[model samples]
Target chain A: MALNVNVLREEFPILHQEVNNKPLIYLDSAASSQKPRAVMQAMDHYYETANANVHRGAHTLGDRATQSYEAVRDTVATFINAKSRQEIIWTKGTTEAMNLLASGLSQSWQAGDEVIVSRMEHHANIVPWQMAAERTGAIVKVLEINDKGELRMEQLDELISERTKVIAIGHVSNVLGTINPVKEIIAKAKAKGIVTIIDGAQAVPHFKVDVQDLDCDFYAFSSHKLFGPTGLGVLYGKQARLEALPPYQGGGEMIERVSFEGTTFNKLPYKFEAGTPAIAEVVGLGAAIKYLESQDRSAIEAHEQALLKRAEELAADIPGLRVIGEASNKVPVLSFVMDGLHPSDLGTLLDQQGIGIRTGHHCAMPLMEAFKVPGTARASFAFYNTLEEVEALFAGLAKIQRMFT
Target chain B: MSLPNLETFKNNPYGTETAIDDVLENFEFLDDWEERYSYIIDLGKSLPEFPESEKIEANYVHGCQSQVWLIHMQDPADGKIYLMIDSDAIIVKGLAAVVLCILNAKTASEITNTDVEAIFEQMDLIRHISPTRGNGLRSMIELVKSIASQQ
Candidate 1:
């Protein structure tokens, strides 16, 4: 069945609002998606009824909170096909998850050991590795991308060396919108015994992600991007891989036994989750996953592709407008730079017209540098966005070009 | 006390003749954001050609979405400050022009004394000038003010 995007739009209350005297056309979902009423209501319901600390409460509300919160672990494990709930770890967001993995994994790194990351990674993916390398005297290596914004898969063989400790890459390019061939990359890394970490922050939203099939040791994503609440993310690690590493944080939840000499850490997922976690956010994420499961994901994917196709077609007609990333496989993200207009100017003008698009380096400065443009105006579409909104974006761009050029 | 290309700074007419009041009046004539932004873009285009050499780290204004370069010189001859600004984004450059118009060609105390936020508020451009936009207009104004205070 064809996805009724107009009906889907009703689920997201934010989509109906007006900005700058015009109906809001939210195209910055890549930055952060607009939340649905279900997700919001779930969070509100959790706070109203089951608001209590998890794993410690003897009271009824405690059991309810713990049950709902722990249930999300099972939901997420199934969502990504993780081995068990033990592999699911709650985090502040993908950034913190990367930091956890990077810090925990880097403890074993020695001098001259290498960590390979793609040029297309968000700073969240890159910076943590750099900091890890700084601490361990490990060298951070680059997996270069071609001019077409696709990873040079051939270079991966050459880039992988005997001393390569970890291979961290994004499953999708946040800026270029290129859905990277991470499965292939992960296979090579697995063969070499190098731990593979996939940044799935941008990928999990647009499509289904099966971590086991991909064979990636670690997969990290934020709940906000997945139509859940903010300040919550998930790190799905292979049970063995997580158990081998030291605990990421030391706090009440992550503790097993405390003594003056040393403290033993909790097992698997709890070993990483130190503090009192975002209990409400965990419940909300469960609802988000349920919401996604309720939808026809394949249809949503097709609809998003149609939106991108329409955007590309319209972009072709606009004089001086050039789509930055033309990778054969991508999500519904249109990143473009005009001949004479700066992206910030385009972004500002688009905002005035009630079109919310992302402008600037998009936290992928290396990719931006490779593209040889300062930045690109990005209009990222979600499943709820209508075809008319796509048309309005091009219309707004045309109006902006007429005004400036 | 002096900056290179003093002649370049003195020739620009943003704060000297093109006062903030004139800009406010021109903005008042425009009805909508489209017209106002067009006028702002025009104002950006009117900026004197900034020397390519001066677009260096020393003059770069941080915290903007677009790359912005701002250089100011207090004229020893006239006892007044002269300012020049540029940005990769035309709207930001236009915003820089607005800042230059209000704060340029003034004495140290006068430049420091100007409430650029008030002027922006009056023009209904408070949103653009907000620190959140990261347009560097706020940083530019802060830089101008700091430069004036140091003088």
Candidate 2:
């Protein structure tokens, strides 16, 4: 259970490689994590053994395929501690999930009803709400953030009015890596009888997420970020909420009975899952969760924190290396901009030394606007990341400085 | 984020169409991608000074990995539109140089008729630039073409 990068690194086949004649040092986990052998095999084995259209197949492989597919539903349910497997609806990923939620919520929201979003939200959380508001005649309000990039929790009362219909926010900021006060925020919103939607795309990758503990009405996350295959997402909704909301998409699997007159919709989760779902990806996600449960998450958190602290200490060495998002609580996301070097230039220079870090606005342009810069070069750590990788980043950065200046 | 003085680009060589041909020749001479990357970055060092005052939202391209500002002038004598691009990043600036060397000083119709992607292919830049940068490059070209077409 102890965090061992050397041992864990072997589990990831992609990690043991060279880039630009140097060992690959990947710190872009915030974007996507490298998959372990288990996840890849689970998906591959599913295709090789049980490959058929699920829920409709009646033959040998069909029944086996359906069983394997439904088994992952139970796996995800336990992974998030959902009340029942029926609450977990499959989508393409977080973006599709957001769009689905927005479209469904639009049918319920009335004109002039207020939808609250935060300043640090990724476009996934913000744009969908805006479109929902635009469609429903509801108004979108923003919760502000302070200097440290932490949401101003003090202003929550002022932001939430009687007309506030929903409070949609990110559980963890993708850019700042701030672990938001989501539990507290959910409680306050619940007290006011406001619907709470938490974007857990960033949170699910780093720590354990219990929907019951958070008491959120809806939670969304992507499997790819959790070291699983892409084109798969999980959206956990309260059973009652799922029943009340209209279906996001209408297709073969989502219908109970299709008629030219009127069609009856399917039950809770299937109603949201429109067409043929990502069966192999669902299997991969189950494997990713199983792999995660095998580790001591607390130790993973500690290892990541150690890496971040070491990077911060190294920041003092670079004369103008400005660290952004100094949130008191965070995962392992380190966003910063050098005094003279642009983020893309820094990212390119680092890439040459076989280090991969994300640069630019990172799909959060408003956050960049608020920070008064175009973008920041970010090196986000994961459990597999090591102290040596941190040192490599600094060495590459030092070389970049030498070349540029 | 103020940029350092780019006064060295006063007599910039990459401001004309012939510069594209020059780049094509130089790219042909390079043996590997690393040398080409270095060559492109060196092009960035020669960016002309874009005025601080012109760095406003009106001139800004919305969807770029780095901050990209574009300014242009239409010559009455030749009916050609001369463009200048600026970015905070070195490689992006180099990309801007690549763009300008092909499309700058051409009339709007001439710019539209120009095979920009073909030129990019000739340099084999499609394989070199990152996907995000490739998107940014496409966005810049689109912005340029859309604006030129409006005139």
Candidate 3:
């Protein structure tokens, strides 16, 4: 059966509001998705009934909080098809997860070691590795992308060498919406014995990602982008790789025993998750995953693709408006630049029309530089977004173009 | 690069001819956001031609979603500050024009004392001046004030 978008839209209460006296047409889901009522209710329920710290609390509330928090690890592991729940380490967000992996893995990186990252990566993926390189004298190599906004896979062979210690790449481009061929890259990196880190922040919201099938060393995603509460993320590392690497942070919950002489770290996941975790956020994320599990995801994917198809069709009729990414495989994201107008100008006008879109570099400055555009106005879609909303966006754009001309 | 043309800054009529009161009255005349924004965009279109050479890194204002360049000169004779602002985004340019109308051709003390925020609130344009908006209107005001103080 087809996805019932009307029913799905009912689940997100924020979709029914009006902004600037017009019905709000939200198209900025790539930045952050609107949380479902179920996710919010789960979080509210946790705070109302069981509000306590996990792992160390002795009371019944503590036990409930601990159970709720720890169970999400299993959910996440199953969601991403990781081998074990021990591989799921809680993080503040994908940025923190990347920082953790970069700092921890770079500890073994020798001078002149190479860390490979694609040009299409978000700043979160690129900056962490760059910082790691700066600290350890490791060299950062770029795998370039073609004008089509797809990674130039041919360059990867020449970029990789014996000294290449790590390969970090985004599973999907946040700005371009290109679903990268990461599984192939991971396989190649695995054959070379190089550690692989995939920034799955954009990918998870759009499709199913089986970490074990991809054979990636580390995969990171933020809960906020996954229809869950903010301030929580997951870092799914291979069990062996995580066990071998040193702990990223040290604090209350992460320590096995503390003494003046030396402190031994806790087991697999706890060693990296320091202090009190985002307990409420974890519960929210678990609820979000459960909500997703209840849905027909393949149907959702089809609905999203149909929205994109209609958008692209309408976009082509508008003169001098160029869609930025033309990759064959992409999620429903439209990054475009209209001639004789700046992106922020478009953004402001669209906002007046009660449409929300993201303008500027979208935190992918290097990608902007590569495209030779100051920035592009992006309208990203989620499953709940109706075809009517897509039409409204185009109508708004047409009016804006007419005004500018 | 050549120094900024003092005559261009001195002759600009943002504050001197186009007062904030006049702008407020015009905004009140407009009924909806579309009319208001159209008026603002027109104001942006009326901004004096900014020199391309002046658009260097030194003149750039940070924290803007769009690129913004601001240059100021204090007219030695009148002891009033003169300003020039430019932005790639039309809305930002419009907001910058509004800022220029408030701050340009004012004495250092006068520029420092002007309640720009209150004026923006009165004009119902408080959102544009917000730092979170990332349009650089707030930063432009800061730059204008800093230049006025130095003068």
TM-score of 2: 0.88
Ranking by lDDT: 3, 1, 2
**Residue-by-residue lDDT tens digits, candidate 1, A319-381:** 999898899999999899999999999999999999999999999898888989988999999
CAPRI verdict (incorrect, acceptable, medium, high) for model 2 = acceptable
Going through the candidates in the order shown, the clash numbers are 0, 0, 0
Clashes of 3: 0
Off by over 4 Å in 2: B1-11, B15-42, B51-63, B69-83, B98-135, B138-151
- Candidate 2 global CA lDDT score: 0.86
lDDT of 3 by residue, A95-143 (tens): 9999999999999888999999999889999999999999999999999
Question: Once model 3 is optimally superposed onto the true structure by TM-score, how far is the C-alpha of residue A11 displaced, in angstroms?
Answer: 1.0
* Candidate that beats the other on DockQ, 1 or 2, i.e. the better one: 1
Tens-digit lDDT track of model 2 for A1-405: 568889988989999999877899999999999999999999889999999999986698888888888999999999999999999999888888888988887887789999999989999998998988888899999898998999999999999999998899999999999999999999999999999999999999898899999999999999999999999999999999888899988888999998899999999889998889998899889899899888888998889889989988897788889888999999889999998788888887788788999987888878888899878999998889999999889988887777666
Q: What TM-score does structure 3 among the candidates reach? A: 0.99
Which residues of candidate 3, in runs, are more than 4 Å off?
none
Q: Can you rank all candidates by TM-score, best first?
A: 3, 1, 2
Could you give candidate 2's per-residue lDDT for residues B1-94 as a string of tens digits? Answer: 5433233222345656346888888889998646776787888877777778878888887545566788777766667777778887788888
What is candidate 3's local distance difference test score?
0.91
